[model samples]
Target: MDKVNRFIQFNDESVETRKLLLYERIAQALSNTPYMKVTERQLIEYQPKEATLAISVFWRHRTEEVTNLGRLSDIYLLSAGFYRQFDLTAWRTFTTDIKPHSYPKLARQLLMLLEEFRMMESIQKSRAGTQRAFKVRRDIYAEFHRDRLLSNAQRGFLADALINQLYLDIHIGMTSSPHDVFDRLPIDRVRQVAQRIFETETTSQSASLAFQIIALVEEFLTGDIVLPLYTFGEAFEDGKPMKQSSKAMESEEQGESDVKETIEEEFRTWHRETEEEKGMHLEFDLQHGTEGASDASDSKPGNEDAEVQSFGTGRSEGNEKEIGAQPEIEQQQDQSVEPTLQAGSDYGHAHTQVTFKVMEVANKTDTSSLSTLSAWRINHLPIVRALVTEMKKRLERKRQYKRENLTKGRLSSKLTTMLTDERPKPFYRKQAPSPELDAVFGLLVDGSASMIDKLAETKEAVVLFHDVLRELNVTHEIASYYEDTFEASKEQQPNFFEVMHSFDENRVDSGPAIMNFEAHEDNRDGFAIRWMANQLGNRPEHHKFLLVFSDGEPSAFGYDRNGIIDTAEAVWETEKRGISVVHLFLSSQQPTEDQRELFATMFGNKTASSDSVEEFASQTLRILRKLLAIAVQ
Candidate 1:
């Protein structure tokens, strides 16, 4: 394949991979059946009449397009319901006994619908959340079939009654319009049919039951059972005609060949009679030096000289002004329109380009230094453990108001009141620990040339950071950013933003990706931060933290002084959207007055600076504690 085709294929595979991974995580959390598994397949691969138990989702309906958490939750609930209740072996045996040739397609379809309704009801009884998801899905399905049902109703088709029965079954007790045709159906009869199907001992019996129900509905429709037929009068009121078109009077319909082009054109002379006369007069004056020419001879010589000099100077100034204005106009147009940046490619973004290269530390001794740092962190694990414990406590407190669970820590005030207010006995309950954390972290490292000297220390600090977060089971991503030196230009930004690690349950293996980080080219801090923020912003996490590791101000082509302002603005925008952005300065030397002011302007009080490589780990830990405190609070 060519480059374009290869790029498209890679993106398609990446999306599918991400979706499969997400599905696996959800299944692991919710599926109790040991053999249950879920995978993605193209919708076209599955036959319309196939009876296999699998979910068919289009590529466009991936989790990223919808609410990822909710979509995954719904998928899990559906999968779990199928796994728990759907006996594949029994279903296969039943299908074999009945045979596809013996079963009517309509009867099979009705059986499938009944099975889906039963599964949803069963799952909803155990999970209140699943109830909401099922309701949404049912409503969507009903809307999709609304037109077909209406058309069938107009034709007095018995299948319309069956579909309406399914709709009424799904929306059993929900409030609906009084005039709705489905509401007019015998709801109790529909319920009885559904209950009978649910009580079937086997899939074969269920199919037989479904066919009987269909026959009964057909007989009822053909017999005295009166379905309230929809009428045009119900939708529109009688009214007088407002206007009539000319075509309405035509007795014969117009054919395509009868149509003709309606456009007409006329041409007129350009010069008018008065304009031609004036042109002749001007020519006569130029040829014979007429009376009009003598009028200039009557002017004073001094006044004429002044006018001549003023005219010459104005022409010179006009030429110079035009010359100076051309570049400014082009610059204004350039600034007014920003080119779109295509992501997930090496040389994509108009202002930034990205490439993946193995990270190399200049000093071989730095590897030993990293080992030494790791040893120190191991010794200090007790302190880190204490910090983690405290942070979890705060998180638990924050989550208490939103959740109710049995706990031994305290008595339930409401329960106590109910039991002791009238009686002599009191009741007590304990709160359960929160099931999940509501935070996600994004670590953005500056990969500019200036970071080369501090690369080793940064790597060690990042590895330790990863370890700490892993222990806490926090969802996070680590990325590095720098300009692509060869492709960098003022007009086209070729900055590279590399993902060292992604947010995944299996984050323990991120050490290798992080270790591959190496400094490169220049840095565009604001653009890189915005890109990272976009990644974190779409996440369902309540508390988002984007930590930036850089030495000084952003430096890139056309980004020297304005880069600082842009970075500050990007930070403010991120924080305004409920994300916390913290800057970490990695210079070993003491920060100068200028550095302090610049850092303060970019990060306010959320900025932390390390004096040397030895203190990198300690400083990072301190900064993380501060960040966690703010997030938990």
Candidate 2:
């Protein structure tokens, strides 16, 4: 009681000013309610029917966030907008004008609930035409009442009191999906909502609840989803030197929880899987703690703390060159008016980049942190983390082993005297020049009808390429092609392409064979291979190249050998613009005369036919280093 009394009496803010602030907050909340009359004239005839879809989508995200925020009641009238309904005391205050002696908890709860609901909810289901439309009406009553009462109390209910909740919802509803309600709203709503939310929220996120709420909001609002390109900067066999986290990027993502426990669990699972596969070259095994290894100085000579710091995932900030330096492809329009990355220019290979873009249900600015969240949650992060960690550990092992030998005046097989300098150099491939395409590299894979037999094998090839390309600061775009040619042009260069007979993209299992769940003539590889080559042909930079696997379907980049039909000649014209074609003919049949001629011309060697994508990809990997070296050089 004294806490509340002391807070009000000593906090010298004027009551009248607070009252005005309260009205502003109520208006903000009311603005978010569907079908609310912005002007007095609209009130007479404006039926809120159109707002139903927005309201439904908004309510969906609202439901999830409120539940997680521990403020479900605020979004739901089930227990008076709380996960756990409050007592009559909460109602008494709202139904009557008299304020309670100490309802700080109620105010706080309402603030948290409303903040979560408003921020996360945007793409609401329309109740206007449905039987349950009345429920949204009920929600408006509860939400508006709570907001109004908090304002009338002449106090800032939550730190987010000044936030424009309506704008936040509008931002969350926008998407390319015709069903999304955000298309009707102005994009300014996203910016305005983000600003208000950012302003009203605490300067620092202090609690787990705050983090969760922030994460949820981010997941719901970031306006676009830019699929990450896996780079090669981090690629190396286990036991080789490890790159510093800052070298490649704010190493792509992880959470703040028991990361070690998660890591250990992955370790165990990895070992089990490898053991099951009878790993020929690699398998996980726990190392025992060696005695006398405590302080940094006491660390084994080669396994020094500096060599392989336990990589904790972080964002693109430490010495960040650029974070997603260029804008996304979908937003690219009127390029001459608005500058964009030139064809084959540095579009995805900046070693250090920091992107400020965020993602969410509706994809607004307020939910931007979710960009990092999604990045953190990416499966590649841990897989790559473990890969990098394992690489780091092996390097440390190799280092310590060499250090011991050096003390004894001996040498290990891993080290060889370098010609450049007298210093011992590890047996590793020379680092390639940065392709310098962008702050990120995008690998758009073609998975369509013709690419069917090669699909399974291409999986590893994609991951392997992803590992190297991402490490090298490159992003990729992989999609299918069947009959129809896929195209995405960024001022006459590849941006992101996906077209399987003109149907929309659905990532994996996308072609006629995969989607129809049946068979076909299987000549789709011609169009698929041609499309990939054409996409690569648009690039002006020689450094950026395309790695494609096909069955040699008599396809030309655009035309045969030298004709305009050959996009390859155009693609290959760049300084290092090479298309190192590798085909693992996943067909049991021997290469026919035409097929042999095609494969021989495209890939240097005739088809080495296989039945699956895995074996073919692995077989292809062995030759990749040489082919890539030649291409980039």
RMSD of every prediction: 28.3, 31.3
Per-residue lDDT for 6 in model 1?
Answer: 30
Cα displacement (Å) at residue 127, model 1: 59
Computed on alpha carbons, the lDDT of every model, listed in order, comes to 0.56, 0.31
- TM-score per candidate: 0.39, 0.24
What overall lDDT, based on C-alpha atoms, would model 2 receive against the true structure? Answer: 0.31
**Candidate 1 lDDT score at position 599:** 77
Supply the global lDDT for candidate 1: 0.56
Per-residue alpha-carbon lDDT of model 2 for 1-633, expressed as tens digits?
Answer: 001112454442211222222322332243333111111111111112111100111222245333222222222222112111222232233323213313322323333444344323221222122213233443543465445434532443222321223322323332222112223334343334333443333212212232333333333332321211111111111212222223212323333221112112222333333234221122245678756646676555554456664544434445433433334433332231222222221121110010111111111222443343344336445545554454345434444442322323434454534444465543433233333322212233443355555444454444454454344333343443322224422212122223221112212221222122211221223223444555555655444344444444422223221221122222223213455444455443444554444444434452355544445545544444444344333
lDDT, residue 193, model 1: 65
State the TM-score for model 1: 0.39
lDDT (tens digit, per residue) of candidate 1 on 175-199: 4432244343554565566667556
Best by lDDT: 1
**CA shift at 512, candidate 2, in angstroms?**
19
